[model samples]
Target: MFHTILSQLVGTAIALFARVVTAVRGVWQGVEPVPRQRVYFANHTSNGDFVLIWTVLPPALRARTRPVAAADYWLTGKLKTFIGREVFNSVLIDRNPQTRREDPIVQMVTALDDGASLILFPEGTRNMTDQTLLPFKPGLYHLAQKRPDVEIVPTWIDNLTSVMPKGKIIPVPLLCSVTFGAPLEVIEGEDKAKFLARAEAALAALAQEVAR
Candidate 1:
C-alpha cells in the first residue's frame, strides 16, 4: 500500500509537469473522473500514453487505476523497474515471450478479483496506423462478460499518436486530449465477437468527439 501511494504522489508530480507543457503547446481538456471499474481502451501510439492517462485520472482514482503494461519493456531496466514496481503499480504482463496472450489474462483477472480498475490499450502491439480502432483482443471482452458489474469504458486518446507517435522519445509535448464515452454494458447472452465489435465502435465514437 505504501508503494502504491508513493507511486501516486510521484505520478501526480510528473503529470503536473506534462499537463503544463501540454497546455502551453496546445489545448488539454476533457479530463474528468472515470466511472469506477471501467476498462479503458485506446489506440497505442506512444510511450507517453501511460503517463498521459495516469496524470489525467482524478487524484483518488489514480490510486487504484492500474495500467496493463508490457513486462519486457517495463520490467528490465532500473528506471523502468522502479516506475513499474513503485509508482505505476502496473500489471506488467509477458507480451512477447509467451506463445499465447492468455497468460496475461490470468494475471489481470486476479487483479480485478481484488477490485482494481485498468487502463488498457486494446491493440496488443503498437502499429503505425492513423485510424487505429483495432479489433480488440477478446480478453477485454471476456473479462467484461465475466464480471458484468464492471463499468467497461471506451476511451479515445487524440493527437498522442502524432504528437509523440511511435519510435520517438522526447515528447514534443502537444495537448493530448482524453475522451471518455459512456460505460459499455455487456448485454445478457451476447457472444464474444459481437461484444468486442461493439466495444471498438464505442471507442471510435469517443475519438470522434475529440476530433470535434
Candidate 2:
C-alpha cells in the first residue's frame, strides 16, 4: 500500500516535471480523448517521448495507460527499475530474441487483455538520423492481428528531439506537441508487409501535418 502510494506520487511529480520542461500539449486531430481502449503508436525520437504523451493524457486515461518499453534499458539500474515498474507500470520487453524468455507480442496482448491502453513506438528504437521516421518493426502488425478490437492511434511528437537530444541528461525547455491522428486497423486479409506499410504511412502523414 505504501509502495503504491509512493509510485503514484512519483508518477505525478514526473508528469509535472515533463510539463515544466517541455510545455507539451496534446492535439487530438483525428480522435477524442475519450475513455476508449487504444494503442498509441508514436515515432521514437527520445527516451522521454512516452512521458510527454502520458503527461498530456487526462488523469483517468493516464491511470490506465502503460508504456511498452525496453526491459534491458529500464531494468539495468535500481532507480530506473523502480520508476519503470512501479511508477509507470510499463510493459517491459526484452529486445534481444536469443535471450528473451517470453514473446514480446504475447506480453503486449496480455496487457491489453488486462484492460490497459498502451503507448507504443512501432519503430522499435529511437530514430537518431535525419529521416523523419525509421521503417516500423513487425510487432505492431502482429499486435493488431492478435487484438483486432483495439484502436491503434498514430501519434506524432514534435520538438522532443531538440528538447531531449541523445545522451543529454538535462532537457532543454522547449514547446512540444503530441498530435494524435486517426485510428487505423488491419484490413481484411491484409498481409504483414502491406499492413505495416500502411501503418507507417499513417504515422508519417501525421509528421507531415506537424511540419506544416
Candidate 3:
C-alpha cells in the first residue's frame, strides 16, 4: 500500500515535470478526448515520447492508459524498474524473440482484454537515424487482428527528439505537441503488408500535418 502511494506520487511528479519542461500540448485533430479503449500508435523517436502523450491526456483517460515499453531497458535499474512497473503501469515486453517467454501480441491482447488502453510504437525500437520513420514491425497488425473492436489511433509527437536526444540525461526546454489523428481499423481481409502500410501512412500524414 505504501509503495502504491509512492508510485502515484512519483508518477504525478514526472508528469508535472514533463509538462513544465516541454510545454507539451495535446491536439485532438480527428478525435475527441473521450473514454474508449484505444491503441495509440505513434512514431518512435525518443524514449520520452510516451510520457508526453500520457501527460497530455485527461486525468480520467490517463488513469486507464499504459505505455508499452521495452523490458530490458526498463528492468535494468532499480529506479527504472519501479517507474515502469509501478508509476507508469507499463506493459513491458521482451523485445528479444530468443529469450522471450511469451508472445508480445498475447501480452498486449491480454492488457486490452483487461480494459487498459495502450500507447504503442509500431516501429518496435527507437529511431536513431535520419529516416522519418522506420518500417513498422508486424506486432501492430497482429494486435489489431486479435482485437478488431478496439480503435487504433495514429499519434504524432512533435519536437520531442530535440528536447531529449538519444543519450541525453537532462532535457532541454522546448515546446512539443501530441497530435491524435483519426482512428484506424484493420479492413476485413487486409493483408499484413497493406495494413501496416496504411497504418504507417496514417502516422506519417499526421506528422506532416503537425509540421504544417
Candidate 4:
C-alpha cells in the first residue's frame, strides 16, 4: 500500500539522518544479530533513544524491530501518530494510571505473540543521567515469563543523555554508542525482583563497559 511504502521511506530517511547526526557506533559484544524474535531493552534517557537504537540495527533487522512507546505522547498530533504507528511500527500503550482501556502488558504480549521483535525501555521513563538508571518496572519480568522462547537483549547507549538532555530543546552532536550485550536469561522459578535485579545488573555492566 501507499502508506507502507511511505512509512519505509520515512523510516529509512530518519535512520540515515540519525547516523550522521549522532555519529552512532554500534557494538554487539560478540553476539550476532540473527533474524529471529527478540526483545531489545535499553536504558532510556532522551526522546531520540528509540530512533538511535533503530538506526543501529541492520536494515533487514530494523524492519522487524518495533519500539514500545507511550500512546499519549505519540498519539497527541496527527503527524506523530502516523509516524509512530506506520513509520516506526511502534507499539503504543496507555501509561496513564488513572484511565486505561487496555493493559500494557497484554498489548506487548500480543505483539510478541504476532512474531514481532520489540525495543523496550524497562525504566519506563527517561533517567536524568546516563550513568545511573532508574529502577526497572515489572513489565519486563512479566514479558519474559510470557515468552520463554524470545531472547531479551540488554542494550546500553552512551552519550545520548548529553546529545538530548532531559530539558534541552536543541541537541548537541556527540559520539554516541549503542552496545548490545549478551541475551538475558530467565532462570527457572526466578521471582520478579530477582529477575529484574539481574536484568538491571546486566544493563549496568554494559554501560560501564561502554564508558571505558
RMSD for all candidates, in order, please.
Answer: 3.3, 0.8, 0.9, 1.3
Which candidate order results from sorting by TM-score in descending order? 2, 3, 4, 1
Pairs that collide in candidate 4 are: none
Candidates 2 and 4 compared by lDDT, better number: 2
lDDT (10s digit) by residue, model 1, range 43-107: 77777776777777776887788899988889788888988878888988887644546578788
Q: Tens digit of lDDT per residue, candidate 3, span 33-60?
A: 9999999999988889899999999999
Error of 3 at 37 (Å): 0.3
In model 2, which regions exceed 4 Å deviation?
Answer: none
Ten residues in sequence with the least summed lDDT for candidate 3: 182-191
Locate the minimum summed-lDDT window of 10 residues in model 4. 124-133
lDDT (0-100) at residue 178 of candidate 4?
91
Q: Give the alpha-carbon lDDT of every model.
A: 0.74, 0.94, 0.93, 0.89
Please provide TM-scores, in order, for all candidate models, with all chains considered together: 0.86, 0.98, 0.98, 0.96
lDDT of 4 by residue, 1-212 (tens): 99888988998888887787798988889468778898989999888999998998988888888899999899999999998999999999988868879999999999999888999999998888534789999999999998989999999988887888778888887788899999987698899999999999999999888878
Q: Which stretches of candidate 1 lie over 4 Å from their true place?
A: 1-9, 24-35, 97-102
